[model samples]
Target chain A: MAAGEVSSLEDCLEEHLPPAVLQHVWRMLYGKDTRKLDLPKSALTASLEKDFQLKGFGFEAAIEQLRQPRVVRVGLIQNKILLPTDSPVSEQVAALQKRIADIVEVAAMCGVNIVCLQEAWTMPFAFCTREKLPWTEFAESAEDGQTTRFCQELARKYNLVIVSPILERDEFHGDTLWNTAVVISNSGKVLGKTRKNHIPRVGDFNESTYYMEGNTGHKVFQTQFGRIAVNICFGRHHPLNWLMYSINGAEIIFNPCATVGALSEPMWPIEARNAAIANHCFTCGINRVGTEHFKNEFTSADGQKAHHEFGHFYGSSYVAAPDGSRTPGLSRIEDGLLVAELDLNLCRQINDKWAFKMTGRYELYADELAEAVQPNFDPYIVTE
Target chain B: MAAGEVSSLEDCLEEHLPPAVLQHVWRMLYGKDTRKLDLPKSALTASLEKDFQLKGFGFEAAIEQLRQPRVVRVGLIQNKILLPTDSPVSEQVAALQKRIADIVEVAAMCGVNIVCLQEAWTMPFAFCTREKLPWTEFAESAEDGQTTRFCQELARKYNLVIVSPILERDEFHGDTLWNTAVVISNSGKVLGKTRKNHIPRVGDFNESTYYMEGNTGHKVFQTQFGRIAVNICFGRHHPLNWLMYSINGAEIIFNPCATVGALSEPMWPIEARNAAIANHCFTCGINRVGTEHFKNEFTSADGQKAHHEFGHFYGSSYVAAPDGSRTPGLSRIEDGLLVAELDLNLCRQINDKWAFKMTGRYELYADELAEAVQPNFDPYIVTE
Candidate 1:
C-alpha cells in the first residue's frame, strides 16, 4: 500500500470503539494485498480507474488434456446512489444507470464475460427509512423493468451477461413487491429471475416492512459463460443458502449485498470465502459502497438516537476461488469494480481433491433434519 | 509483533513456491495479534508458559439478571509425539502421557472446566505411513484404553471434563479399529464416544487404509460445564458434520485435528471459524504441532517421491466465537495450549440476533438431500 493509504487507515483506528464493534478495524490496518493475482490493466480500464477504484485478479488452474479450460471473467461492481432519498424515482434510476453503464463498458474492455451489480443497484437503500411512498415507487416489473431494459442494452452492446439485482414489482398474480435478481443474457434477452429467499428484520434492516420472504427456490441460471446463482444480501449468513445453489449445479454463486460496517463487516470476508471452500465453487461477494442518507431519521431500536444516515456500506467487493484462495478486496470507502477471471475446471479439481460431495453423506443429514422438523422432535442430546 | 518474529516470517516468504501451494505464507507476514481479547497471565500459568507457548482469551457477553451466566473455561492442547515412530510402543505412550499430564495440570490451575487433546494424542500420526504393526499396537478400547484410563485419572483429580481423541480398538466387536473421541465426565466416568464421520482420501491422509467410516453418529455429550461434541480431523471440511452436532444441542464443539500445512493450512483457519458462526456455537480447533518422521517412507500417489515425514503439522490452534470473532492462533511450530473462557449464554444471544435457526428452513434442505441420495435422482441443474 502507499504511505498515504496507511495513514488514512490508521486514522480509522483512533475512533476508540470497542473491539467487537470494530472487528474489521485491525485488518484495515495492514492495508496490503493479501493475495497476488494481478490482472494487467488495459488503456480503457486505466482511464476509468481514475474515476473509481478498479482492481482485479485471475484464478489459475492446472491444464487437463481431455478437457478444454473454461475461462470465465466475472466482474463485480459496487457503487453509491448519487441522489438523495427524496429525489424522483426516475432521476435516481437514470443516475445509477449511467454510472453502472460506464463501469460495464470498462469491464467489457477488460474482457469481463459476466458482470454483477451490488444489491438493489437501481435506487437508494431506503428500506431503513421505513417510508413506503417514494421508496416503493422504485420497484418495477422484473420482466421489463427500466433497470432490466438498461442492463439488456448494455449486455448486448458489450456482449456480456449482466446480473441486475433490483426491487421487483411482480404483476402476475398480484402487485406484490419482491427482492429479485434479473439475469440478462449476452443476446439481450431476459433469461430468468431468482428472488431473495431470506429476509432480515435485524437492526436498521427493516426490509420485512416492504417485502416478505421470496417464493422462488434456489435457482441456477445457465448462461454461455457459466452456471450462476444469486444469494442476495442477508442470505449469505445462511450456509444452506450457498449449499443449495451448489447442489443445483452452480459453479459460480454471487452474494450481492447492501450491509453496513457495524452489522456485518467482520463476517463479510469470511462467509463468501468459506462458501467457496465448503461448496467447491467460486463465490463473489459484492457489497454496496458509501453511506446513503434518507430524508427521514431512523432509529435501530437499540437505544441509539435517530439519525438520518445509515451506517457506512463497506464496499470490500472481491472473489473467492473454489480452492479457498481469494483476491484482495476493493476500497472500503470508494465505489469500485472488481474483475476476476476464473477457470471453471478448478471447481471439479478441488472437488476431486477434497471429495466433499462424495463424503458429505447427504442421506444421513436428510434423515437427521427430517427427524428434527417433527412437531414432537427430540434432539439427540446426551444429558447426564 | 516483535521485530525478530517479523524477520523470521519474512524469511519463509523467500522460499520459492507457487502461490497456490503456499497459501498460508502471506498471513504469516503479519505476525501481530488479529484480535485483542488478552487473558491475564497468572503466576501458575506463567511457570508452565516457559515450557511451551501458552496463550488465552476470554469471550464476554451481555448481562442478564434472569439467567445466571454459564462461563465455561475450555483448554485445547496440541503437541507433537515426543518419541520417534520406531520407539517402543509402551515408552511412546508413557512419554506423551507425562507431557500431557503436565499441561492438564496447568489448565487446572488456570480454572479450566474442560480440556481436549489433539487427535490420536497418544500415538504418532502413523496412518500417513500406511503401516499396521506398531501403530495398531497403540489402539485400545475406548472404554478402557490406556490413554482413556490416564485421562480418567486426570479428570477425577482436576475435576475437569476431558475429551481424548484416540484410536479405539473395539476388541468386543472383532477387534475393529476406529478414530474416536472418548469423553470423560468431570467425575471420571467414561461418557461414551463420538467417532470421526468423514474419512479423507486426499493427499497423504491415507486414513481409509487403517479403518472404514465411523459408525457412531454425531453425538453431543451434555457435561456439567457445557453440551460439547467432537468433530474429529477431516470432519471439519464438511459443513453438515458441524450442523449435525449443533442440531444435537451442542453449545461448544471441539475439532481435535491432526493436519499438515501443505495439505490444509489455508483451510484450517476458515472451517472451524465458519462453523462457529453458522452453528451459533463456540468452536475450538486443536491441531498437533511439529513434524513426526516415520521409520519407513511413503508415497502420496501424486507423483511425488517417497518421503519419511508427513509435512509440518502447523499447530495454529484457535477458538472462534459464534459472533465470528476468533483469537490469535498458537505458534505454527510449537506445542501449545489455547485456553478460552466462554459464556454459554453468548450462543443463545447470537442465535437470537441472527435468527439462523428460525430462518434456516431445514425442512427444505432435508427434502433436497433426500432426493439427492436416490440413484435415479436428478440434480437441480439448469442448462442453456
Candidate 2:
C-alpha cells in the first residue's frame, strides 16, 4: 500500500487473503467479479493510444493491461464545516482547515487513496443570499492559499489525490473569484486546475453573484492513480463539458456539490451518474450532508414558502462505475465516508459493449450547429 | 386476457397457474389466508393522489383492499420501418402505412394498451445527409396525414393510446416542418401533439434538416391511463426540457430516439433515466434496432474513415420507475417486445421517499438567466 508500489492483481489477492480463503477471494476479486471486469487487450490498447495520445515503445500493450487499472479504495468526505456568520474571517479559516485535516487523518486510517471533499469545502456556500463580505474573505488563490497548503501536506502524508474545490481567488486577474477545482498530487505539488464552465444562475443556487463562468476549457490532470477531471457541481448538467473531459483522456471525474436536495434534490445523483455513464468514466459525487442554515430567506418560482436556509443536504454521496452499476451510500442524513473500489478496466469493457463514441454521427450536425450559432441565421430561410 | 376486460389480479393469477400449485400460488398472490395484505390507508390514498391525481378520492384504498391495479400488464414496441428510397412517393406511403398496421396487429395480440414508436417513425432519418427531396416528400401534416390516419385507426381498433411521432409539415408556415409527437386517443381522435423544443444540430444527428426548433413549450397530456409527455431524441439531452414537462404535470415521459450508441452511445439510457428520477415520473425510452445504410459517406471530427452509414443502432430499450429502478430490455442486436406491469403506486412511494420537486429551490437563477439571454441591441458594437 506504499506510494509508487505497483502489484499485479494475483499478487495483491495472495497477500491480502488467508490461505483458507485465498481461492475464493481471488475469484471474487479477480475472476469475473461483477465490478472489476477488464476489457480485451487489443481494444484497450487502441483506445488508450487514440484517446490518451500515449506513444512510446511497447507503451500501448503495457498501458492496455494497465488501462483497466486495479481497483483502489476511494473515500468521500461529506464535510459540513459551518462557519458562524459573525465569526472573523481568520477564525473561520482556521476552524475549517482543522476540520479538513481531521477528516484526512480518518480517511488515511481507512486506507483511502483518493478523498474528494464537498464543493467549496473551505467556506459555507453563502452565494444564495448575495453576501458580499463573505465572498471578499472566503475566496483564496489555488497555488498559495491556506486551503492548498493544508490539502498538499495531507496528500503527501497519505499519498492520496486530494480533490479540493474552492472559490478560487485569481491573483493575476484583479483578485476575481472563480469556481475552481484544484488537484493536489500525492507528492504535495499543485496539479493543474479546471474552472467550472456552466455556472448556474437559477433557484437558490445564485452562483453568478459571487463568481463568473470559468474561461478555461475542460481539462484532465494526470496523477499517480489516474488521469482525473473535475466538473464542479453545475457543469454536470452539460453533456459537452463531460465529453470534452472524456475525449481528453479522463478516466475518473469527481463532482463535488454544496447546497441541498431543496435546490436540486430531484436532479442530484442523476446529473453526476449520467455524466459518468455517458463519458465512460468512473464518477464520484460528494455532497454536503447537514442542513446548514443561511442568514437569508428567498421565495421560489411559485410563491411557496422557499428560503435560503440551505435546504436539507440529502447526503447521498455515491460512486457510479463506467458500466452504470452504482454504489449508493449514505443518503438524506449525514456524517460518514462513502467508499467504493472501482476497477478502471470497466471503462474499456463498457466502451466496447456500448461503443457510443465510435458510432456517433458528428458530421451530420457539425455544419448545422456552425450555422445555428451565427447571429440572425435562420434554418428555415429559403433563397431570396 | 381479452381486450377491454379489466381482469382482477386474482383471476389472472388463478388462470395463469395450475390447480396443483394453488396453495403456494394463493399465498404468493394474496399474501395472506384472508386473501389480502392490509396496506396503510394513507399509503393507498397517497398512491391514488400521486399516480392518478385523483384528488380526495379514496379509490386507491378501496382498490388496495380489493387488490386491484397491482399487476397490470404493459408492452413496448421498438420499430424501424425505413421510408422507401427507390419507390414512388405513393408507393413509399402505402408500404410504410401497411408496416404500421402490421405492428399494431402484433401489439394487439400482446395486449399492449400503450405502444410507443421511434421518433419520426413514418420516414427514414434523412436529416443525416440533408437530402431535401426526402424532407419534402416524407413530412406530413400532423392534423390530417397518412401517419395520423394510421395511428388513429390503430388506436380505435386496439382501444389504446398510440403515441406516434412524425415529421410535421406545418401548413400555416410556408415549407416548414416541426419535429412533432401526436398522441392519438382510443376513440380515433388526435389528443395533442408536442413539438420538440431543443433541437440538436451537433454531429450526425442532424435534426435541423427537416424540422425547426419547436416553439411550443413542454406539455403533459391527460389520458385515461395516465398523464404523459413526449420529449424527442435530441430533446433528451437538455435538463430544462424535462423540468418544463414535469412542472407542467407529466406522470410519464416517452423519449423516442432514432440515433444509436455510435454517435453518442454512452448517453443513451442515462439522459432519459435521469430526467425520470429528477422529475419523479415514469420514463420509457424506445429506440430503433439494426443498422442502416445511407446514400452518403462522411468523415468524423478527427480524420477517421467515417461513413454517413446510419450507425448500428444499439436498441437498449428500457423503462425506469420513479424510484430510479430501471429494467433495461434488449441491447443493440435484439429485436423484440419488452413487457412490464408497473405498479403506479410506486411513483408516490418514490416521491414520498425522495421529494425532490417539492423541496427544490426553483427561483434563485431567474434573474441571472434573464440577464444572460438578453439580446444586445448595441448595433454599432464591433466584434473580434
Candidate 2 chain B, run of 10 with poorest lDDT:
B52-61
Backbone clashes in each candidate structure, one number apiece? Answer: 0, 20
Q: Candidate 1, residues B1-384: lDDT per residue as tens digits?
A: 111221112123333334533332222222112333355466246536547777767877789889999999999998878888899999999999999998888788778899999999999998888889989999989998778889999999999999999999998888889999999999999988989999999888999888877888888899999899999998988888999899889999999999976677667777888899889999999999887888798998889899898877878888888877777678777778788888999999989888788878888888888887889877665554
Candidate 1 clashing pairs, residues 3+ apart or interchain:
none
Quick one: RMSD of model 1?
A: 5.7
| Interface RMSD values, listed in order for every candidate | 7.8, 15.0
lDDT by residue (B184-270, candidate 2, tens digit) is: 877778888888876765556666656777866566777766667888887776555665566666777888888754355545656
Candidate 1 lands at a TM-score of 0.91
The model with the greatest DockQ is 1
What would the TM-scores of all predictions be? 0.91, 0.54
Q: Which ten residues in a row have the lowest lDDT in candidate 2 chain A?
A: A53-62
Ignoring the other chain, what TM-score does chain B have in each prediction?
A: 0.90, 0.76
C-alpha lDDT (0 to 100) for residue A285 of candidate 2? 79
